[model samples]
Target chain A: MSLLRILFVVLVAYPVVLIMLGINVRHRARLPRRGPAVIAANHNSHLDTLALLTLFPLHRIAQVRPVAAADYFLANRLIAWFSLNVIGIIPIRRKRERDGDDPLVACYAALERGEILLIFPEGSRGEPERMAQLKFGISFVAERYPRVPIVPVFMHGLGKSMPRGEWLPVPYFCDVFVGLPLKWRGDRESFMGELEQSFHKLKEKLAAPEYL
Target chain B: MTRLSLPPQVMYALLGAVALLIIASAVVLALARIRPERDYTELKLRIKTWWLIIIVFCLAIAFHRDVSLVVFAFVSFLAFKEYLSLIPTRRADHRVLFWAYLAIPVQYYWVGIEWYGMFIIFIPVFAFLYLPMKMVLIGETQGFLRAASTLHWGLMTTVFCLSHMAYLLALPDDRNPAGGGDALLFYLVFLTQINDVAQYVWGKSFGRHKATPTVSPNKTIEGLIGGVATTTLLAVALAPWLTPLTRIESVAAGVLIGMGGFIGDVTMSALKRDIGVKDSGTLLPGHGGILDRLDSLTYTAPLFFHFVYYLHY
Candidate 1:
């Protein structure tokens, strides 16, 4: 990360994640210290990326990049710059219009450099605290990097704090559960099934009441 | 470095608190050693969390007046946020919730400036009317009454009642001979918490009859009476050093705190039971959440504040 990016994460991101909205992490020891790894989490709010980033030590922040939607994050110049540099997101096109285009190329490059890639398999934040169907794109990434450990993280209450379409965030306590890494099975179906099962198991750990 | 100045009574109270914590920690450690087969994890975690709570609270109170007010406001914000997160609300209530949160700082600002008129009425008179009006603008009448009532009740319990404790700091120094506002704030909190622990201990040791079996099964009539007696005795003993209360008024304050603490605890228990959860959130390691810890204070703070205000201020 550049000086500006580090400054932003230290001055802005850390306070927001650590203080303004406090997080209680379970099985924190399970988080991978170094990468060439994949972190798949349930998306609820924009704070998801920042929350995950703060989990890592500051020295290793540059090595952790979230896989975000290019069209949404890179829509405007100011946001695109902040998204790319400050947040350090690996923006991938959600829609592949060209027949030959590969959206996972940037992710692959990041992984080859032994960096951690954070992906939200739900593709978009659908509803607060409700899990949507997992997109198969993550399975493809798992297949290509079979040696890499795909860590599944289940988060709660970030949605209610600052869900989609809400500008201001109320201070709600958040819980994050990190699961043991899931290896890619033989094919996409089994891999997706295992990923979904991991998320379900993590979610069950919290035993959260039905969201309002 | 400038020496941190605290009133002599507050200083001794803090020291006494530290000593008590030390003893509790030693007892927990001994228990763990003696009962190796049993699970003392929760007890150990509770003691550990208490240390953190005390340290943070001491720093907040001893740092500066403005900082302490901010700390209180933040606590209210957390409790309010937790309540809103648990309760059901319509999608239309989202924007209105933001306005509800904005009420925290504004309420505390009144306390900071020592404006009693605004502090007492900001939530009950103004916010009670303004929130529903904002909801009406959203035009989602589906479950509007439930939404409005829950929101207002949460504001009352979490923000309005809790702010009374902060308002103690705003009380004129001359009126309190014992050490002014901080001393009274400490006295109220100390008594309320002791009342809670006494009730729990009394209920545990010799509790045959349930107090509120449906709401809080652990609460017993024996515990209630024992807790109140203990609090009353302690209040009378500590009143001379901590407050401007006479002997009779001290006993009244004690009974108020003890009973009010029970009501507050079970009120939160009822909320948790209604929501179908054991704890509010996992913010504190073993205590559950901010709301769980502050539940007794929600009632006792206001009740004790008013009692003292009427007598002294």
Candidate 2:
């Protein structure tokens, strides 16, 4: 990461995660210490990436990349620069118009370099605190990197605090549950099923009363 | 700018508090060692959290008044956040929640500037009226009364009541015979927390009859009487050094804190029971959340502050 990005993480991101949001992480030890690794989490708010980024130690931030939609994150020059350098996102095209274009190319390169990738399985953020259907793109990545351990992280309350359209964040306590790593089950169907089940189990672990 | 200086009395009181914490840590450690089979993890974690809480609180008050006020304001924010996160709310109330949060800094600003007039009425008058008005703009009428009442009640408990502690710091030194505002603030907090511990300890040793068994089953009649006695005696002993209260007044203050603390604690328990959750949140390891730690303070702070403000300030 650049010096400016590190400064931003230390000053802005740390306070937002540690103080303002006050995350309670369960099974935090299950998070991968090093990569090549894949973290599949539910999509909710833009703060999801920032919250996940903070889960890693500051020294390892450079090796952690969040796979984001290019059109949304790379809409303009200034945002493109920030998305590329500051957030260190690997912008993937959500829709491939040309048959020759491979959307997973950058993701493949990131895994090859032994970097951790954070992927939100839900294609786009839907209603706040509501989980949308998981996309099958992550199954392709699992097939390519069969040996990499996929960690499932279920987070709650980030949606209520700063869901899609909301710019101002209300300080709500968030709960993060990290599940054990699962390997690709040799087929896309079984692997996706396993991933979906793992997420369900993680969500069930936080069966407390819903506030939002 | 003037250098930050705590009153000599406040410094000695802090030293005394640190010593008590050390003794508590040693005692818990010894108990864990003596009974290896029994699970003392919760006790150990509670002690460890107490150390962190006391150190952070002391640092905030000892640094500067501005810093201390900010710390108190942040505490209110955390408590309010925890309360909101635990309760059910309508989606329409989301924007109003933001406005509710915005009231914290503004309320604390009034306390910071020593504007007692504004500080006392800001939430009860302005926020109470304005928050519902903002919610009305959202055009959702279903469950409107429930949302408004819960939101306002949370502000009253978490922000308005807790702000009295910050206001203590703004109390003029000349009007306070307890050295200054820091000493008074420490006195209230120390007594409230000690009262909690005393009640627990006394209840554990000689508890038989239940006190408000429905609201809080663990609280005992013996604990209430024993805790009040201990607090009253301690208040009288520490009155001259920490407050301008007479012996009789100190007794009244102690009884008020002991009973008020019990009511506050059980009230939170009732809320948790109604919500079908154990703790408010998992912020602290063994203590649940900020609301858990400050439950007693929510009652004691306002009661003690007004008692002193009326008597001396």
Candidate 3:
């Protein structure tokens, strides 16, 4: 990792993890020690990526890359540099309007290197109180890399913390639930349904009446 | 006084704590060996944690006043952060919450500068008037009152109340005769924690009737009486060396701290109950969180600071 990445991890990541979000990662055993896996999470805000990135062990952060929207992340020079160099994110075009290198190829390359690929299957931010429909992107990746385990990550309170269009994030309590990883044993449609259901189950468990 | 010249009371108290820690460690070791079958592991962990906290606290105070102030500021920040994280906040309050977080350092800065006037009124007057106005400018009124009040209460308890400890240390030394301002803080913290531990032990040993069954079921009338009596006696014994208070005044201060400490602990309990959380957060190993540890200090610090300031300073 570069000096700036280390600085970002220390300054940005640790503060957001330890101070701001007070992020409690649950079922950490589900996180594969060695990865050629897809970390599929539900999206709520831009903070979702940062939360997941910081949740990984510092040594493993170098091997982790979040799939961010190309137009938003790659538009500005400073942000592009920070996102690409510091956070080490892979930008996939949302509208597919830009004629450039394929996003999936970058993801495949990371997977080929035994790195962990973080993808938000919802493809966009939504009201965190509810989950959005899962896109076929995860299914597409799972089919190609059938050997890779696709882990479903369910996050709560990121939407309230740094909801869409909000510059300053309130430090709300956030819990990231890492569910059991599923293998590519079923069809794409069935697998996507299963993944979405897994998130719902985790969300329900988190919202259960049991107090802290 | 220079950095090296600490009050005798503070030094003695630190030494006393070290002595107690050694005895406690020996007992824990003995318990482990004697009753290996029984689970005394939690007590052992709590004692270990206490050792760490005592060492860190003594080192901070012993180093310099600036270091102690910074350490207290960090404590207030942690308690404040934990408080904000535990509560349910609205989306519209994000900007206002940022302002609330900013108030921590600014409030502590007032202590560092010894600006008593600004320190007293900044949160109660200026922030109180300004935060709601900022929220109004955002043009969201759906839950405006709730959001504003929640943030304000959080500021009052976490930052405003806790900052009194820093302010206590900043008091003019001439007003303190027996010991300097640092000893006063140490006395208050040590006595308040003893009061808490006494209440728990008494409650477990002799308590039957619940004091506030719904709010804090663990607290009982028997425990309250026993704890307050024990703490008052301890306070009277230690006051001559640690504080400028006369014997009668020491008794009064002990009663204030014991009663106020109970109120603070129960107030936090009520908050946790309202929020549907068993503990504040998982910050410490044995203790629940910084908030959990400092709950009694929250009430006792401000009450004791004002009492001493009014009578002496």
Candidate 4:
């Protein structure tokens, strides 16, 4: 809603999304019509959030909140401003998880408010070729709101485009695979396993020649 | 200098282009009606794109010189982006790529100020040396030669070659023959494009032997000759109004642009072949990408610039 953030998205973020990322948002029709839903994607680069946020329908963007790590997103005043306001990121303290604080609390509140919470369940950026173990935080939040749909998203090629440790991004084609959403059945372990399996299936489907 | 004035030749040429487009549209419409079952989607989309391109380009050149430069600057930026996106690059070369993108504006800035010295040397001298030096500091020589060559090639074709059109527009009003800079710009674009269409038509009609079978099978010796001859004749007809060249010199310039246009297109084809892409990108609906639309300009722009610059400037 901030004027500066809108300007930044239009002038800076959209161009980066189009030219640098070459983002293809596939299965857009599968995105839940409304929220109190969770959109979980594999983390590969910093661009994944921007790509997904931009891919979300513009009218419903205000209700889309991305869950970002506190240490990374809140590292500075500028980044924090961009993350908090521009991206509407719900900063969760990943490092301070054991300090009697539940990171899922903020996410749960967001879902309860009918906000679409975008969380990278891998907890951090990982290799694009493989998906890491899904953090329990995602399933935990989904169980509290069992009716909510958890959409499995697979991002292709952002890791090489603007991976961690690279100050500048190279132009690379990236595809965002939005799969059908799954509802929580209250079994955290099986839910997480199914979520991971869904990601693998999405990745395989995208990699197949017929999809291209 | 009548800075805001549009030359009579430019006005007349634009009118002619509009007339041609309308006639072409009618013909295509008739063809669609006659052959309703055949797919005319791609052809219709190409014509639609031509309408937009003609309007945008003519409007750009119709404005003040600096505004036109900005339009070309934007084109260069997109072309460069498309080229880089298709090519392989390393993480270490990201900073250098940033500099390469920055060079687009700076190169056009030279045209804005008419600084020929810096415009000519900035990319070749400063960018050429600076990219490698920056890569050396990164100290990753894994794909060093391949990376450096691709970066330089992207800069040259995307920024350096494409910027020549802006520079041609920047030529002093008095030195650019009777129709001045605007006419000259339109002349080059019009002729180069017509040359492309001519080649396609000729190739389709009478093309026999493949020019470069492996590199570009569609190009043929017959097409090349027919295209050059057609362009040369058109050049002589439009010479007095569009360019400073005398009739004979216009014929020579026509040959240069015609051949250069073919070479540039096939060069891009070879690049697409090397990279194993059918099209550079899908920005333009039927044209595949900006690179696909402007490939001939990559060669024709610089060749025409130097030819004019040598004769007049």
Could you give the interface RMSD of each candidate, to one decimal? Answer: 3.4, 3.3, 6.2, 7.5
DockQ (0 to 1) for model 3: 0.32
Report the C-alpha displacement of residue B97, candidate 3, in angstroms. 0.6
Off by over 4 Å in 2: B1-5, B281-288
> For residues B83-124, could you state the per-residue lDDT of candidate 2 as single tens digits?
887888766777899999999999999998999999999999
lDDT of each: 0.87, 0.86, 0.81, 0.81
Tens-digit lDDT string for candidate 2 (A137-171): 99999998899999999998888888788888887
Q: What ranges in model 3 sit over 4 Å off?
A: A1-4, A96-103, A128-130, A207-212, B32-49, B282-287
Compute the lDDT of residue B231 as modeled in candidate 1.
92
Reference-based lDDT, residue B274, model 3: 87
Query: What tens-digit string does per-residue lDDT give for candidate 1 at B255-290?
Result: 999999999999999998988877775433322577
Stronger candidate by lDDT (2 vs 4):
2
| Pairs that collide, model 3 | none
* TM-score of candidate 1 on Cα atoms, chains taken together: 0.93
User: How do all models score by TM-score?
Assistant: 0.93, 0.95, 0.91, 0.88
Minimum summed lDDT over a 10-residue window in model 1 chain B is located at B279-288
Ranking by TM-score: 2, 1, 3, 4
Q: Kindly give the stretch of ten consecutive residues in candidate 3 chain B with the minimal lDDT sum.
A: B279-288
Clashes of each: 0, 0, 0, 0
Better of 1 and 4 by DockQ: 1
User: Which candidate gets the maximum TM-score versus the true structure?
Assistant: 2
The predicted structure with the larger TM-score, 1 or 3, is 1
